[model samples]
Target chain A: MLSRVLYVDIGKRSSWVVDKHDIFSKYLGGSGVASKLLLEEARPGIDPFSPEAPIIFSPGYLVGVFPCMVKAVAMFKSPLTKNLGESHAGGHFSSALRFAGYGALVVRGASEYPVAVKIKDDKVRVEMADSLWGLSPLDVERSLRESHYEGMQSVISCGKAGERLVCYSNVIVDRYHHFGRLGLGAVFGSKRLKAISILGTGEIPLESPLAVKEMYEKLNHEVVLSGKMSKYHDLGTSANMLELNELGALPTHNFKDSRFKGAEGISGEVMAESLLRRKISCPGCPIACIHLAGLRTDFAPEHEKGKKEVFSEEVLLPYNYEPMYALGSNLLLSEAKNLLRLIYHCEFLGLDAMMVGNILAWTTEAFEEGRITLDDTLIKPEWGSVEAYLQIINNIVDMKSPFYAKLAQGLLETSKRYGGREYAMIAGNNGMAGYITGYGSIVGALVGARHSHLSNSGYSIDQKTMNQPLSHEQISDFLIEQEDWLYALYSLGACYFCRGVYTKEAVCEALKTVGTEKTKEELMKMGKEIFHNLYKFKVREGFELAEQEPPKRVYQVQTPHGMLKAEEVKAIIKLYIKKREGEGLRLKPEEKALKELLR
Target chain B: MKKALRFHIDVLHPERCIGCYSCVYACSRHLFNTIDPSRVAVFVRLNGTIANPFSVIACRFCKSPECAFACPTKALQPLPEGGITLIASRCEGCKTFDCISACAIEALALDRRTKLPIICDRCGDCAKYCPHNIFRYEEMK
Candidate 1:
């Protein structure tokens, strides 16, 4: 059993189980599995905060079977993004839940009061959590651990951000890792769920012992030795700062510029030298891409009298490249201590740091341009002002003022309210993170997905176009292939990190272990079918690819690569629409052949 | 020296487990049997959010052996190695869920077709599978 399904309804305080065999088999679990479940349970046009919005958690098939790098996805109608929202968090939780004999957990309705679910093997006990309701994730974790059996239980909790229904609130697992995107935490809070504790001791059987041992040993060796994984292990995602900055793709000051002049201050090299303490791995992951940074802060206060004492203090926690880029260079905060302070505020508030940073950057630009007054704005954020940013972050979590409440709603809503649609740097209502590489596949992916970059990176298309100019038709074909491959990976419930290790042969082999005798070609075809299905779903849900384009700033800014002309970009969009229609109609070669035969 | 040793296995340190399925992989690797996690002697599951942690459940290796007392076929026997072992050959395939209900810990599972009791023999192979030292083997004096 990959996982067991646990269903609970907060409305009636009732719970039951669903086999979910069909879902698990088709999607191979994780986000793919959860997305299907969400679609079924979550009806369109329903308010995300309504009782109808079901929250589902699905663990990957490989979670409790494979070694390391297990991730579980949380899916719901996002209050913030206001679309199909799903977020993945890598930790011991998913693997443990699978081991506990559950594949998925779905919560529906709303609790009358705050409550926590504690599962000890087969027996589940719902405990009152009135005291733990407004506690931060840290405090909640500490309290729950004390009450539960020592060394045997884990707790998941939300902070003040979630309690206040901040649209970017995240569900914090352990102390650091989270389902940090698409406002899953807000969904949990809306359900009045405080935390869930699961404990189980069960075993999974395999058909071939010798084969599994061989595969595990071989895969372990490959992961540790692979160059792709080594880079992640060495500096984690922070390594990208140097690469993206050098490539002139790093978003700076709300993407007003691609390159940050103070890029050196926040490079992975600087982080490793001045802040990094150790690398933290999720579960059995060998790559261990999480770097725990130890930050020191020392700033002298002004005194009218004599001299003020200066002291340094250190704080340690995990930091990743996306958060660093979003909160650091994007906000123009060059000092490591100030950036760390902002990072800490995001964590404590249970907010998606990237979304918050992006929102702040946009607000700063708007403020500078006098598009919005200080009185009209939430906190009057200034570029590179750590003190001001920290105060704003606190205000959002605290829900102190009306403007702060609107700001807490996230960039999409904030921009809409403030008449900044043109300046709003968002894709699919989710703030864009990946640099302006190209419009080939990523644009289509952003437009196609609920909300994510993994739907289609199109980085390859950017690379190809850079080497030599390609026709729009050529770019469309390239994007279609990338999207198909990505769809296949998601369906397999495999992490992108394992893509290198689980090539065509490896995927086939893994499938065989699960009693599926699928050929690589057949699997690829199935992946393509899933991609097409998702594309159709988006269209049905009102996604228009032709309408989705990079913000105007992308074309205006002169990137290191070259200046992108608006007409060239628009032509690419037209080509993409043609290709999408061509694919949708299933008429590329066949249409040409029929016309030729008729003639 | 063939006296049956009375010992218990406690899943004490579950939080340390990353749930890599190392134990599951180890069991299947050694048993040459396909076991669903629902039937495995030991299992781990997520506690809550990704940042929260994991929970573990395994045969507590109860001293009284409620499962053995409840087994009508007398298949669940105390092993000399200090845990309960099942005699799969003697099982009646009755499809009765008595053992499942009798054991307070829910540690017993029945094989799919045979409907025979399946219990942990405490081979310590699970300890070998634990990559993070979440499980361990101990000998009684």
Candidate 2:
């Protein structure tokens, strides 16, 4: 009853609910449940855009039951990495699924026409979204909310970039949160799926009310009173911008420089003082880490007004370290308002800010080197110029030229054709994240399941070893240790920002109140199992660790320690592979046979 | 401190609300021993867009509660301590939730499963659990 899975077929326009107790009991929920469902629902070696490819949305067991456990996981074959497509988003989505009495929802088979799947408790309908197909994410959500459902609802939608099949497009959740890293939005587009709206009015049953209340109070007190999460509520993750820049770990101008001279202009402190309009949170989170900036844009174009020549309106856009680095320092657009404008445009187009920023940076350098011409870019790409970047954004979405179309494919493909592979600044075919710390950050991205910095947080380990020399073996050990434990926390669908609060013991205690008893040791073992499960799917799809090499640009930049050596990084990566395979984690013969049988 | 007669919850600072739903969760848990949005007395809503702050809806503890007057069977009664209390036996579980419409602030809502009005009894659980101190349970004379 606690682990019901809703299977929806878009081609058939039908849906059914099944009690997936075996999957939930073994894998738990969130990433674990979603990965298992993807394995069972997908055929090996099929194109990620294939209609039969499965998209699984799952909330962890502790979600909606424990404080700060607000994230939900999405798993599929990534159009970006061509491997495990795993992304986590924090919003009302997880709690919505919880209150709807389902642990996971899987969509299989593509629709011939654009559609929006609407769910109200037990009712599910695939409605025609003809009017909303071409709208932006914000417009799509507004249309669905105003015209379709009433009461509290959570909506996940894609926009024009996804419809164009841009490889790095993202799915926006509840207007602000997102499955931002991978190409889930493109996957939605490939299925002709515009949006999914959920309204959950069902009451969730508690195993023991008193036990839950006690644990909830304890966790809530730790989140609010302990002062651990106060920084997030005050300035959010953008607080890292100034600190990383000071440490020379912030990637600037496409990794040409490690620190930006104008970092203070767009720092979190300045944004909070001048641009911060409001702070919000996901449904159940008390920290309120989401910070929105108010950007006043002049809407009037050649209009005669009574008092002024221009009419302006203020718009709200969320800002954190990723966008701050991607649009601000990394692209050399240091002005806060300018960075916010670019972020708003990406949100409107449903493009991944980080990926687009990486692409733009690479193009700028190529243009400066005379490797690319104006005919290829349509606009002369330049660093620190918002106008040029904005024009490029328009071209990429419209696919104005062959070069622009290639740019929409992503960094790896764009660099391959454009002759800039050395400076592509990517790992595992995905654009490198905000961190450019050292070998740890680079190797972590290369080896990570989703090729994301948050996958292992190796950058933090690099920071810890800045003052002290750490062997490559020590770095590899630390990185794997972080990933294993983080896998467990992520399985609970808790926010990574709250990892400080949800220790292994804390996770164990919380799971018990929900009638699932898990010891710290068991939770850790489960983490390794889930990690292997993800690799199993990735390996089945022909993902190889040796094939994913960090771009040469990563080693060119000067980190806090010094310039990194390629040999040192390669040695660390080799050790990482040995450690991973030494754990006797090869795919079981029965599991492999089952996958083939499912196919 | 002065001894007071009527004690009820009051809004202190609406602007500081984060829309965490902790108060709603606490109220539901306190009343029904479960965390269900349908059974909650306090309602939280985002104001227009993410740019704007959140709004919290709770009983105003009106001296003459409109909810009490609109009930067909007089299931809702105004308590001496302020706010309305529901009489379970008198409640018809009717489809016509006139009490919900009669509330000026729209603080009252119907339980989706039970089809009965969820009236605030001024237990002050919402104020007790509010992390931002948006609510104040005061004794008014």
Candidate 3:
């Protein structure tokens, strides 16, 4: 009975709930339902920042009911990629939304002034939030938490970057987690929306309690007692640092070198031994993968009567593989403390760490190449200079000058203007993730829906091929197969980290317990169809495969599998295109209605 | 005859809590056959920092429970296991909810639909499912 879809019009300051039984029953939920809604709600070729563009939040069917099913999917037209903007985050959001008795929430239209949307179960209120207009993401969360449900509700807010409409800005979820990729925060800013707070105390009845308990215990036992997930709980994905570095697959210094010599300095082992504080989890997840680092920051001395002159405060910041790679080796920053400070600034400003690292790296290289001088950049950009990077982050958020304004648009566009398209290290106008592994990685990223590493994990495929070689055809087939199945798992709201546990069989069994029955073959087919549907939206929004070529920098590097040429990557992507659609891309909208498609 | 050994769930290591809320969900699933926070007897909340980040609220199982004494409808009664038990039929769904205020630990919650007090029955489900060993089920002295 997960059929409720809540629509809130920010411009009209009104809300309504609609029964989307056909959507839920046919498409399942999460990204599947989100895709359908996006096509229906957003007008074709409309500007992403337009008030009419919709921000759809859909928590999959399994969310709030199963262990590790903690993610909620955010679907919007990305201001960054200017195509389909999709991101998933884990926190209290999915559970809160589920218990609020809705399968999905769509926010449409823009407001004239800054406001916050607060939903306590069915009661939705759009209130003026002028006081929270210029706050950082962390400060906004703190302010909303204190004023709302006494820190019990889930809150998502944008930083100054988002408010300023930085194309690469992100939305922080419940302080630690985020709708990190694309530019959902920019969308929030475009609507003049400040924050969203949700609290739910409603009940969802279990159809067969004993059956659910049996299935739950089985999965929970596999998750906790198996010791397979110990790596995730122990050091989190930060553990990948040493492994990827050893394999020489780690992207360092703008993909100049495949391995970082200072990898050990910022590896998870060192972080855990020296700076690790406490680990927390999203609701219902036993794996506490969110690792916090405690850094003692000193303030300038303040002289006062009977008071201490200098003060120090401990700041707890979350760290993960992507940011560690992006801010650490990618910038030649070796020290954990220095990297943490830069990451803290980026998180505080609400910028995507991967894009920020890519942009700064490109800027440094561009500075050295004399493509842009001190006139364009007020301060000289250098490698491993934390102060310079911090100032640059602030400048980008503040939109300090015309050059910075272009840089804030993302490195792809900035490089286009500043004359360094070759080494921009971007695919599809989105910055490259920290994986310069090989052909599968670059080709998969170039053609993947969001141009994200997580979209297909092509880097992982490349790593596996180090021992067993995968031909260009094999790699293409593997990426398409993996991407398609992943769409199905995502629609189920499984956290990316927990994908190993929620295998196709486990997914089938879990759904059965909830009175949802889908055969294994049907699930796989659903995955393929969902991926096609996503690509359909992307292509409709002017995404052309011919334009998304792997950057020249990727060709210059020596990966673990040795040198990768552009031809091999192009061949792989071309093969992927052929296999994904047979001959040409499907541009024509289906003559049949969506309900008929379900039939 | 010797009285049966009484057991109660206790917070043994609050420092180890990852704030997963497995216990809260487990309590709800075991008692109500649903995923309902309003019907659960345990609650966990984020405190917004690395140092002492999460606060866990669960029944302390008082011997002479003030909640039972404050119950005007006689819905709450002291159990031998050192916690209060709710007789849902006897609950009048009153407006005041004096029992909720009487509990000093703030462990008591009312069902949004039924308005009956949600009290721990000493089932130890919360302790059994806790991944970090934050809760413990032990015999009361």
> Runs in model 1 with CA error above 4 Å?
A1-4, A146-154, A296-315, A441-445, A463-465, A532-537, A581-599, B1-141
Task: Indicate whether candidate 1 or candidate 3 has the larger lDDT.
Answer: 3
Q: On residues A373-400, what C-alpha lDDT tens digit does candidate 2 reach at each position?
A: 9999989988989999999998998899
After best superposition, candidate 2 residue A578: deviation in angstroms?
A: 1.0
What does the lDDT come to for candidate 2? 0.84
Model 3, span B1-141: residue lDDT tens: 023227767887888888788888888998799987667888775565323567788888888999999989888888775677778788885678999989887788877667778767677878878899998887777
The alpha-carbon lDDT assigned to residue A185 of candidate 1 equals 82
Instruction: Enumerate the candidates' DockQ scores in order.
Output: 0.15, 0.53, 0.54
Point out the worst 10-residue segment of candidate 3 chain A by lDDT. A144-153
Model 1, span A64-128: residue lDDT tens? 44544467777777788666677777755675566567778888888889988776656666777
Worst 10 residues of 1 chain A by lDDT: A145-154
> Can you write out model 3's per-residue Cα lDDT over A164-248, one digit (the tens) per residue?
9999999999888999989999999999998998887676689998888889898898888888688899999999888989888
Model 3 residue A149 lDDT score: 34
- The DockQ ranking, best first, is 3, 2, 1
User: Interface RMSD computed for candidate 3 is what?
Assistant: 3.2
Off by over 4 Å in 2: A146-152, A301-310, A587-599, B1-6, B47-53, B93-95
Error of 2 at A162 (Å): 0.3
